[model samples]
Target: MFIAFAGLPSSGKSSTARALGRIMEAETLLEPEESDWPLLVQERAVMGAFTALTWFRTVRVPKLFRAEDKRTQGGSVIVDSYYDVLIGDYLGKPAFNWLMPTNDPYFDAASAMVREDWNRLPKADVLVFLYLDEDTWMDFMKKRDRDFDRSAQLESHFEMQELMLQASRRAATEHHTKLLVIEQRSGSPEDTALRVRDRLEEFA
Candidate 1:
């Protein structure tokens, strides 16, 4: 079985995925390394590099997926943030907007590359979506040690989050996968994890 956790930044995705892995005694895959192509592309903010990005995706994301597949053959596997980063951050928002300002042929090509990759991946058996209201999400962001340049970008960020959520729902439905939406408002990480584990147990 493959379980995936998707959500916006600081939405408790990593913690919940870890907890679920423990509860299910499943191997867990966290977000890919920061040095990978996705982060590199975003950091560089280069335009007209869609083909390069596609090559990177072809070379890298599959390796991670294959590892997950190998683990699943033996036992259950849980993944944190998997394609969410690709769809939400890399393609949906910052990378495209911040980097590819021209919105030229390369940008269009890159978007298609991202879409192709999203379709290529095997759908999770269970997809858990973690979301918080705007105020709560902003609060959570502020509490983090990261810089707060998001004041201007919040609206777009929220839009991207919603888009990702919709895509997740569509993917789940199309693939006949089980979908679990968790509205995380007031609760400790442990409490949220408990709820996720309990919900998943019903399907188990």
Candidate 2:
């Protein structure tokens, strides 16, 4: 099985993926590091968003294909994030209007890029959304202590949290993949992983 987790920045995706990987003894793949990504976006704004999005998409395609290969070999693989959230939710979406305006030339370029590459990427067998309420999401963001996240307006994050859920549903439906929304606020990621494991069994 190839499982992919999608959610907001501090939504415990890496944690939960690690836990689930341990439980299933699967190979867990973390998203590429974006150490200076915030700085890049801050420096160039719109163009920066375009660059970062393009970079993410470029790096993510091979990872998805690798996950598919492992699955074909009968090994389970888990990924910390899915590309659909980036492609569908962030492209010309209100949630990221602060970063990429809908009318910007870069926005059009980014959209065109996604359209060109969308069909090449492999879809996950299960798409999990780590759902958190506004207060919990904000709390996690603060606890993570990233300066960029700390200073950003809370409304943008809130909108993103909501839009991610909506986008996850749409992507799952479009791909005919299993969609699982697991609430992350009420329990530990390990607990959530167990729930996901059980749900995957049900799907099987």
Candidate 3:
């Protein structure tokens, strides 16, 4: 099974992916490192957001392809995030247009490119959403202390969270893929992994 773990920033999807990979002995592909993308160092400014949107589009497809390759070889694969979340982020309020004033033409062109990329990527067999309540989500973000995330307006963060969820649900429905939402908030990733494994079996 190819599984894509997804959630809001700092919601523990990556940690859970790592834990689940260990238990299932599956090959895991993490989100590409931001440090490797020079453009991302700009943070959440117009350049930063645009760079992030474009850069992830550039890299994540290849990562998804690699996961698909491993799955085709009869191995279970896990990915920490997927393109759906990227789309959500792009569509959020104060998105491209709001970030870059009077640049609808560029935004439109970029949107076209991202949509093209999204349409061609391999779909995950299961999309596991690590659902966190609003309070917990904000708490986790604070705990992580990512400067860029911390500095963002709270309202924008809330908007992005909703947009991401909408996108995830849309993807699941469009592809007829299994969508499992895990709402546990206090457990270690190991515990979360065990819960996820059990839940998947229930689906099976």
Candidate 4:
């Protein structure tokens, strides 16, 4: 089945999605980062964000390329993304843009374009939500210790996480995509993977 890893930043969706792909023998459609994006992730930002932007652009190539690539692959075909708002970045402060609903029309339009493109695809699949509570998320972010962030940015990141959850729910409910919200505690990756794998099988 087609699968998507959705969550706030640092929720471990990408890591889990990648592992799932490997275990299930499916092709992994990695998120935009480190590889290429139609635009850069503001070259000055932290490397992680820039990497993600780079990866996202590669996914946007013409459908023919996407379809062709998938043909050579198998398994669940998991796609990784923060599912964060497109407008949030342009209109938001670097540390807090995610909290905004992104009223910018063009950003909203770009989001529409992405959703439409994915929904129209023949292999569209479930939206897997990897959720973590705010405090834990703060701890996770702190561990990464990006210079752009500090204690002051914690509240905003938490707020952004809430908005992302809402957006993901909307995507699943309104767009006919499946939703799997995995609220996990800090722990081993295998433990988390097994928990999710069970969930996947339950739906199967």
Cα lDDT, all candidates: 0.65, 0.76, 0.72, 0.57
**Candidate 2 Cα misplacement greater than 4 A, ranges:** 33-47, 84-86, 151-155
RMSD of each: 4.3, 2.5, 2.9, 5.6
lDDT of 4 by residue, 68-139 (tens): 356557434666653432222222434344322345334455556455544544434576777888777877
Worst 10 residues of 3 by lDDT: 95-104
lDDT of 2: 0.76
Greater-lDDT candidate between 1 and 3 = 3
Best by TM-score: 2
Which is superior by TM-score, 2 or 3?
A: 2
TM-score for each model: 0.75, 0.86, 0.84, 0.66
Return model 3's CA RMSD, one decimal: 2.9
Which order, best to worst by lDDT? 2, 3, 1, 4
Alpha carbon deviation, residue 180, candidate 3 (Å): 0.4
| Deviating ranges (above 4 Å) for candidate 1 | 32-42, 46-64, 71-74, 84-105, 147-156
**Model 4 error, position 22 (Å):** 2.9
Candidate with maximal lDDT: 2
Candidate 2 C-alpha lDDT tens digits along 88-125: 54567777776567877677777777665545568888
> Which has the better lDDT: candidate 3, or candidate 4?
3
| Residue runs of model 3 more than 4 Å from their true location after superposition | 33-40, 43-48, 84-105, 154-156
**Candidate 1 vs 4: which has more TM-score:** 1
Model 1: per-residue Cα lDDT over 124-152, one tens digit each: 77888997898888777666533222522
Instruction: Please say which candidate is ahead in TM-score: 1 or 2.
Output: 2
